[model samples]
Target: MAAEALKSDFGGKAHIALNDPKLRANFRRAMDGLMTKRAAQFADADEWNALRARGAAVRARALAQLPELLERLEARCQANGIQVHWAETTAEANAIVLGILQAAGAKRVIKGKSMVTEEMHLNAHLEAHGIAAVESDLGEYIIQLAGEAPSHIVMPCIHKNKVEIAELFADKIEGQAYTENVDELTAAARKALRGRFADADAGISGVNFAVAETGTLVLIENEGNGRLSTTLPPLHIAVTGIEKVLEKLEDVPPLLSLLPRSATGQPITTYVNMITSPRKAGEKDGPKAVHLVLLDNGRSRVYGDSELSDTLRCIRCAACMNHCPVYTRVGGHTYTFTYPGPIGKILTPQLEGLDCAGDQPHASTLCRACADVCPVQIPIPDLLVRLRTEAVHPSATAGVKGGGSAQSLSESLGWRGYTAMYGSPLIYRVVTRLMGLFGNWVPASAPMLKQWTSVRTKPKFAAKSLHQLAREKGFSHD
Candidate 1:
């Protein structure tokens, strides 16, 4: 899909979502449940901080030596008889996977819950090429039927209510009555998907982590659909970003511990599938042919920048989105990208390029709540500020001049003046008196002054600055 089309669709859907009380309520309930469960899970684990630290360290180490690690991973996978392909961009990645399917003469593909697939819009690509790609994950299948994008990272259809899902199923399934009951919906989805699973020529999935030492592709999921997707078909392909690689096998345990708690608050997912290679002769069930596609897209560029390199450490737990006030109010579509929320604010600009997505960096309130809650302690707020700095730099600003031109210049000057005033008490007093004079010009009830008055009414202009007040009150200047 074109970026403009995706952006327009996202904006329209977001407007509808904003007015949807049912969706809003559902999101609130789901977010609250997940957060409460996560907090409780972490409360008992005294080593949570240490685990987060280790997780961050592991990711950092992997990024520092990503090329070496990827080479090692490819070698190990090749030794185990798994085919690996390297794609420098999205088009190349899609072509590599499509070529594998065509080479196998596969007409049908069953896909698990893979955000990378969503990022690549793989289903649409397959359909455009006359291949049928069935989404096996319950939520993903529902979205595919509805022709909509996933709203949440882990829970793709979090925006849908049970009633909406029931209606969708009833419309899609022959001779089925609409019902909101959970069991009925689940049974309907299962019946619809069983045939696809049995007949699919290939299974495609996303890797949560790729271990260099063992060449293992790790998938963590609650639904077990991922396991089926990787094992049921004769051919299996795992697509993942280059950043998903880890340095050592030992790094997996700490990351595994952090993921479930941070994602859905489960101590462990119902299933964790580790696939090192294709099925061996003794194996009764597993794909006979296995392939791994390491996708770069825009990650390699991010790795070169010091400020953005840390973003490669994200485990995709999406804790930041759950805790983000802006994300909650605006929903995921406002982000206009694959990822959303505070991390998106930083990552999207870097991945998409600041020239195309510079506005994203300024979307945050810089509240730091996301930073506080992040499992890996990524300095998300700090990154956002840096991105904004880059966006408004002289050259960048000159390229995008418009209505905010005067305001931006004024704001820049205001910051410069404030910095100068902070160097001396006398200068600070002069600045405050000037501010007090300006404050007096506006009516107290004016919208511009409302923010200041809401918390405390603007103080009457002082004859002198705080330094004079301190001196008059007999307080030492020191």
Candidate 2:
């Protein structure tokens, strides 16, 4: 499944998603509700702006000294008795995790919601090695059961409505009957997973904020599943991108203030678990050993660019996805990557090469709605434009992976021709006059118009040029 994702067929998948009425309806309803709720949370314009600014500043400060902070984080965590591991790539990270689980003689593992693990394809890797890993988050569990990827960052199974889920449960879950009652479905899921939490050999979770000053791994969730996933088992392993580290504990408040409100429009999540170290000498419930795996996975390449480094400031609040018009219509699956929407458009191509995901940069409408709502004030639209340019005429020094892979001889020639006509006044006048004289004679079946006319009308040209009209009106002199 992950191998197939490397091939770029975004246009084909987007076409299918656009035609699926069920998918479109699901996304429309979900996105609308999320947008409404988030707006209500930020009803006060003054407060919202102030909070967003602070959040952006906090993230920027951490990223500016990311290397120093990471070293500090490792030192502090080791001092606190939490072992830290580093991986340069997903393959290495998977190997490190598999070795840890094997060393502990673990066979069954329960996991909390973590996009980093998804990026690594960690579940598939573990299963291949004869270890069973179960997603404990309700939304994550539903998708896992159905053999699907998450349709949204915050809501994994948002693409599945209650009736669909009820049918799935009835078919998949033992001793379960088909029912649309939300509470009944919830109870059934609880009954199924309740035993796994207690019996699992190990727990794995993602860190929302890894504080360097105190070496704390913070996770926030409404369900107690994250708490259980980290605490119940004797061995706990936390994984996150290196970009998730923060400079200090004080930097957490502004981000915490923005994450939930921007994600699901809540004042705060039900649970915010902070793990300073493994179980202390006197503690009874926490894990006996805790390991932190900070995975670089192309993050350093992204960090090298002064402009693209802003991408690291993302808190994964996913506010950009919630407000994206393109995402609302096509849904997450169209991107064919772990992340979907405005963030994915800029992020995927950078992590994966442009050769693999170059088409993703062209998927946006450049609406700037994502930038406006971003908690960290990332210039999403500007980044999209930069990526688009990189795909064709990339910077020689930038060294973006697979840069210029999307360039084409015909496209380059066409642009050169356009430049030539516009650069010379005599050629421009001749071209415009000729276009006005015979443009309407061109057929919709014309080769140049085929793709454009497939979904739109062929434009009709006036017999008189705008230049001629301006001259007649005494508005111009030649």
Candidate 3:
């Protein structure tokens, strides 16, 4: 499925979860634990701010010379015996991956956690072609068996509780012991996946960063499945967005420094595998063939637009989502896309267009917390405002313009009136006094006032307006 299609389909179901206690508990426990760990990790790193700055600079430099870097990367990879393919769209990317699998005559495929593949819906597409795509990552494996899209970026099954997982394993795994203990369930999954990994004709994974200097692909994961996926199979395929590129090899350390700290609160992930090319002569168990598929899929459009270009700096550490109060309450499913949280809100609109992702920009609280916590310092709140403006005001060339209704006209007029009034204190005092007269009419329990009341009590209106009070106090105002 296309990214927008999947988002639309899943977003509808996320509403049903608002009343689900079990799911809410699952979300709260996992998210809270992860967030606490992340806070501790950041606290330990005294140079966290410095690391973020360096990471941002590296990504900015890479994006500035993306065309040149991609060319250099392609040449280096080819020289190292790794074939490279460019895909301009999701369908083309999926087709390229499937064609490669077909050429290898592969029947079964083992996959590590790769959100790019999820964005392209590569598994479903491959299944339609008679290939069994097995998810090797434990969380991904759980979600795949549940026939659901991932709820979180790094942790796919974050919404599933242990009992639910035990039930899933009981039904799926033949003769497996049914246990809710986390370790037992993980062991069961590992036992099941080990067979698939050994017998699979190919392995598929995602690239965290592709270094142009050495033509190296990096994968960061807590589980060793990423290592297994990249090494064990005879054929290895990596699918990633074009934004994953890094200009020079030295630029990697700062990004690596920031990612794990921001992501899961670890100083570094358990495994950070760097693959330069396919296994050479006398290699001890590595893929014989290696292919890297670089996906554009609307990223180029974002790069061209100055207002939204900062979104391309995302390393997908998912820190914005972790720190977002809105995401913590509503969860990733509410965004209903491959990528979720604050980053997802800005990114989905740019990738899928304003019309397709209408709910995303409005999803934020505009608290600016996400922007403050972002590792790469993408002005997420500012971008969201830009997207909301575009959503509310479609282009005149689109035929159906925005300002057609009486309500919209009134809103525009009200904004203009407020702007003019606020420019002069005399007019502002007049409006303020006028509003004070009607303040008593506003009900304490008004639904429109709930959000304000939730945070603070409504201020008692003064018996006299500021103008009257000033006059009573004998304060002369020209």
Candidate 4:
């Protein structure tokens, strides 16, 4: 695992993702099934909307008092025998985790599916330092062996069909043969990872929700890996973004009820683990030392911006991405970040900077389908537009938005020309007349103009402009 993770080079990723036919088919099948399941679970529309609104309110309130809540959580975790560490950036988070592992004298680590680790490029870092970090989640294991990142948040290998997975297992796993059976594939991965679980010196996991009232980390998953990762090892380290915190234990239920259902359309996932602390005095199982790393990584800055703070409310349910036309076409990897789809567009610029992530906000069609399905009721489309504005006009942000290297003299000039023509009726009429008269004569060598003519011939423009014809026909009240 080289540190050169899929490169945050956004300019060419969408083009590559769009052209991959096999990936497109895989997404189409996966998305259709997920949408069907989601629809079935929410047969009563009113109940769904009510729950969604509650989730939004709870998240907004928690974020409003985040600083106080985090301090409270740290104090409470210490009271429960759990050590908590704060990391302001990905590098700081990685360094803290590595230092903890080294202090425990751990060389082999087993992991549950955690996107924060992916964001930090933790596996590559650990590999470079001679630590073997093994991914135990089936889909995570599949992609790890393939040397590829997870294409979807909920379904990591959603871009790969059973056939592709079968092929990957046959090629990567020793003595394994090719088979497209789903159960067999899962069984193969389970067998391969079970040994790592028993032998791992330490375990790593991700937190879905952190309840500040009781100082507990909540995890939701279908498979049993998350449970094993926390309890089986001598030491456990949980990593997550600071935004995952909740104010009280009671606050977790409303968000939890919606989280699994929103994410995978199940009434409840098979496994939900709540870790309040490490093994106490005489506990037979659970880690001897439990640590929680709360990562800021530009999140505190995002929280400071009133317009973008709503982005922090996301529970990683990913309902927005499921309904997004752009995400459906290009898949997650096209965004070239750990969090992809609608969430990625707003969050990536903050974490990776606009210089690397500038193209994501522009990829949207502004269809607003994502906003409609978001369980937390985050106004994703509005945030997207604000990000675009920040990119094109950085000074407007007042440093509230992330980095932006989007200033372009030529594009700005083109917008000025559009305004000049469209803002005045006489200029608009003249411009239309000139284009209608000589647009075809402008040679095909003019590439930008050729784009317009390619779909529309010069003769398509009528002798009379649309305005003149409308006036003649008495359709214009003006």
Candidate 5:
């Protein structure tokens, strides 16, 4: 498909995704495998519930004191010799990173997998400024080479199969032969990225958790790339949302216990990197200068609402996506945002404004599958309904960004008529009788029924009212 053919809206993109057999098969296979793995990891129901409760409590505590914890984190990080920068928006975040790189005269950077960077569009910003940012995470590297956004948060290239990847590697990687062998393909990528890690002027990454008490930036990955990106270069810069802050280092274990098991069904990842500060004078093999960029990017708005604050409890586990029927079918690209699936449906609208992403809330089937699988137990279905209500009837305090932007006069009037008919007994009876007289006469092509009838049969209305039948059958209303 041409770039111009791609649609920004959810419906258009979903239509394209649903029709593509290859894409559907790729996502179905990936989702099923992930679901099975995650289910196996949490086989004991009692253990799963207890751990979920503990993790939720830990996140709730952190978010409750978010402001104080963030301030304390900055102080502790500064005391530990880690420079901290704060940005209210993605643009500011980009500029802060650029200034840090420019100050160090860094023209090349190797990156660890960070969804926040994707949200910031950091690579494009840096490239436009004449700096090169190379993604070191294998999945990230693959999609970056293909000039595509991540289709899944935990697995960026989940939309493509090995054969497509073989083609991509063959075409994009110089002198690389087409091979569907997973190990060989991985080796090829490692060979290509080894030089970038050693020669890059700086490294950039995303923090999984930032402990306020000890001032540590924690990142977990199955691959060693995250470690190399943060340690191999002389300069390292980490960017993350402010919501990632935790009140204490002790709170890490409960969340960590659930994160990997929920994400990829692993007991533990291969590498867990924790950076307390920059390299000391005698210290070797670490960045000499370390910087942390804390980005708000509308997270504060999400945090402001007590009901919506649950959204921040997410630990970036893709378990919700893996279990979501809608997401599994349409894939992440259909969401057309940095985050996708149930979490994205709620998070994207608040971050980007409902005027841009109002349709996302309505995309769900409200199956509650996402909520059931969420590691933190976020009530995704409830939040979707909340956003839907905010669209037509905005809060008086201007709570949600672009609230009420989806409202339409015709829809509002139709709803009003429905309310009136349902509220009045006489009106209901008269409308039902009239409908029984002429409802079936309404054609499938009628303006209101056309879209509804596309996949479903037109509902036939009875010629006689139920009340009339009851009277004829000698049944009293009592």
Candidate 6:
């Protein structure tokens, strides 16, 4: 959502990110502590693997029948008097939402924590049209007040500690004391958002799982904010990526079990909401009008590829970011995309296309840690490798001339020179002496060498060749 700083230049952004001590420490502590909790949740490797296998099977089957499932879901929702809308892109999704709000004459909206909305960049879109949408989730509200995109999908404000959040609250909300106490801080946030919730003209939320067989929308969260955002306002709007659909209500148990355990190491979240319809005739409370927006936004592209379709298996548990070595060091801001971390590596490229998300796939070390921790068993490392190939060697690109990528002409030329010199013994001898004589004099000013010396000192090549010295000492090739 935040314009990837100097877009598609991962190396440049990573270089700057790698130097942030605070970012590094916060990510390390949070990721490490949460990973420990996750590990504790599954002490039995056998049981854990079994659940993952089950989760993967359920997702594969659901995805295999996605088209049928989606249709069934639409029918079920419509039958319950919930209007369903389909959006092929972010702009289309935003337009659909705005149209609904305008039709209802809604001025103020309160939103539950929905990454799909973030994907659409809906807050800014709404603000541009003079519609005020406020985030109701505690973490989301904090980041929204700070005027920042979520760093972590599951924990939107995971990057901000209690003290930092206290500072933020004291600065933003009027008449609030600067208290670092967690309860006090949460209470302050609750008090601040409570007024907005009651005044909201409409409520918008995201679906964790959509049941096609029964036509239901499922939301899981720790706080009651999700409840307020989806039920309090007269108009309720729900949005989710199309991949969230499941064929049967029975399949939800295994996934529901896996999501919180893998995400926050809890067996079950505090609130598991199932919305079958708007408030019925006898219901005293609930939105009178309800709408569901199914967003494609390149997800169908990912789903269409059999090899990449496994990516859709993600429940947005965000386990990939939790255990990621690259993500932990650089933090989410470095990725400069909505998703960030390993999942972002594969998903961003497909959704945004290779041109806009060109540098994202290479942001990983391909360590396969993400695949190992994934509840649905998405082959993240393999997918990352696949995306990397597509990014660097796009079918239309040859020799990397002018694609607006980090691969420079000088880097390519340097590689060519290295290949030539290393292949020939005579050329190697000539180069080694020239290197020994003047390698240090090559200077940090050299175009190719500057990248290597950006953070560390230049290396000094040895004055004498080991082969020559060995020959003088009468040693053979052995």
Query: Which candidate has the top score in TM-score?
Result: 5
The lDDT for every candidate, in the order shown, is: 0.82, 0.92, 0.84, 0.87, 0.93, 0.87
Candidates, ranked, TM-score: 5, 2, 4, 6, 3, 1
For each predicted model, how many residue pairs clash, with residues at least 3 apart or on different chains? 0, 0, 0, 0, 0, 0
Q: Write the per-residue lDDT of candidate 3 for residues 288-343, one digit (tens) a residue.
A: 99999999988887787665788999999888887787777667777767788889
Give the Cα-based TM-score of candidate 5 against the true structure: 0.96
lDDT of 5 by residue, 1-478 (tens): 1221223499889999999999999999999999898999999999999999999999999999999999999999999999999999888999999999999999999999999999989999999999999999999999999999999999999999999899999999999999999999999999999999999999999999999999999999988999998999999999999999999899998889899999999988898889999999888779999999999999998888899889999999989899999999999999988899999999998988888889999998999999998989899999999999999899876489989997888778878999999999899999999999999899999875687898799999998988889989999989
Worst 10 residues of 6 by lDDT: 395-404
In the range 1-478, model 2's lDDT, one tens digit per residue, is 4643576678899899999999889888989999999999999999999999999999999999999999999999999999999999999899999999999999999999999999999999999999999999999999999999998888999998999999999999999999999999999989999999999999999999999999999999999999999999999999999999999899999899999999999999999999999998887789999999999988999898888778888988888998998889889988888989989888888998899999888888898999999989999899889988998988876677889998988778878989999999999999889889988888998875686798798888998988899889889664
| Tens-place lDDT digits, model 1, residues 266-363 | 99999989999899999898999999999987788777776668888999998888888767766776677778878887777776666656666666
**Residue 80 C-alpha lDDT in model 4:** 97
Q: Return the top candidate by lDDT.
A: 5
- Stretches of candidate 5 off by over 4 Å are 1-8
List ranges where model 1 is wrong by over 4 Å: 4-18, 394-478
Order of models, best lDDT first: 5, 2, 6, 4, 3, 1
Residue 415, candidate 2: C-alpha displacement in angstroms: 1.4
The alpha-carbon deviation from the true structure for residue 113 of candidate 4, after best TM-score superposition, in angstroms, is: 0.6
Q: Which residue ranges in model 2 land beyond 4 Å of their true spot?
A: 433-451, 468-476
Model 4 spans with C-alpha error above 4 angstroms = 1-11, 395-404, 422-430, 443-464, 467-478
Which of the predicted structures, 1 or 6, would earn the higher TM-score when compared with the native? 6
- Compute each candidate's TM-score over C-alphas: 0.84, 0.96, 0.86, 0.92, 0.96, 0.88
lDDT pick, better of 5 and 6:
5
> Model 6: how far is 172 from its true place, Å?
2.1
Number of the candidate with higher TM-score, 3 or 5? 5
lDDT of 3 at 89: 92
